[model samples]
Target: MLKIQDLNAFYGKSHVLRGVNMTVERGEVVSLLGRNGVGRSTLCKAVMGLVAPVGHVEFDGKTISGMAPHDIAHAGIGYVPEDRAIFPGLSVLQNLELGMKKKGQTGEKWTLEKVYEWFPRLKEREHTPAEVLSGGEQQMLSMFRALMGDPQCILVDEPTEGLAPKVVADVAAILQQMAKDGLAVLLVEQKLSIALDIADRIYIMGEGEIVFEGTPEDLRNNPEIRKEWLEV
Candidate 1:
């Protein structure tokens, strides 16, 4: 339940996102795929209120464009950035504990226990300092930390940037499970196969605009679109 219409973003004097329009429905995994410098990650930051944005960002029918990052988060949107922002000194458990919106908040679907269940490796390192974890582990920590907020929608930017194949599979499975659990997942990924495999709908972005919107099969079948906008 997220909608973005005519959205624009800028860095200094250079414009990044231009009239970008997209939507994500409940229980849906929508992938924004493009090569580098197309503004995919900026779109995620714009939606999360991490960057200055113009136009409308509506979540569940309410506008969130001008809201602060925490305000947008408390409104039921979570963000997992490409760089895993983990507190180096904090223990895994402490990091997760801080992830909660408020102490002992109930009625939320995700919990520390549930997150641990999803990634048992995180449970194993429960008391370890976050800085010691591997890249994959750090990524898991970042995602689980966001889930600790029990968001209705999660904007995940480059979830599988640099990881082993098995770890990438794990991350893909987790995103798939998130959709099955009725969370709207907006994934900005460069990996074509992974995105096509998990996304219910695919939006191909180019130069701050959506060039193609279709299903996985449609993307696979369209060589022209792939060659021009996607292939290196």
Candidate 2:
């Protein structure tokens, strides 16, 4: 449902993404796995129109390279950054409402009630300030906030960075449920194991380029592919 072809992005004079090509089919979970500084996040940023790139970012079908960030977000895509960007002072419900704004979207499936159903923790702390949430709670809130927009595809950057093992497992479960429920998920994760647990296909990136891609089993069995691009 999303296509990125020959994508090249630069941060001023520093080029971050080099000829990155990948696609996410409807209801499929495809993950981009790589070590630090490999432009994994940059690829997502470019696709979401957060970073300027020189190529094609087609969602459904139309090009959205030069589109505004809000326009891109409103056009059936949701982004959850690696940092889990949340409003510290705002309440959990308040943070969630930020994504509820509907533009040209129709036939929505996610609402505050649905969000509460998916994440009862957010409901429990609905009136508490975001700063009071634990690390896992913050991560949960971030994911649910993106869901509040009712996006067709969601881009998640390292959803299990600093969490405990149990939290990581929870994240994997949530992402897998999203895929099973017919949402295209593009996950960028440093922890290949966590991603492989939920990802249907994997893209191994090295130095801002995709070096290998296959099913989870193919990646697990190839020693050379692990040696070249994934060992950290």
What's the CA error at residue 190 for candidate 1, in Å?
Answer: 0.9
For every candidate, C-alpha RMSD to the true structure in Å: 1.0, 1.9
- Deviating ranges (above 4 Å) for candidate 2: 102-107
In model 2, how large is the Cα lDDT of residue 201?
Answer: 94
After best superposition, candidate 2 residue 18: deviation in angstroms?
0.9
lDDT of each: 0.91, 0.88
Off by over 4 Å in 1: none
Sequence-dependent TM-score of model 1 = 0.97
Kindly provide the TM-score of model 2 when superposed on the true structure, using C-alpha atoms.
Answer: 0.95
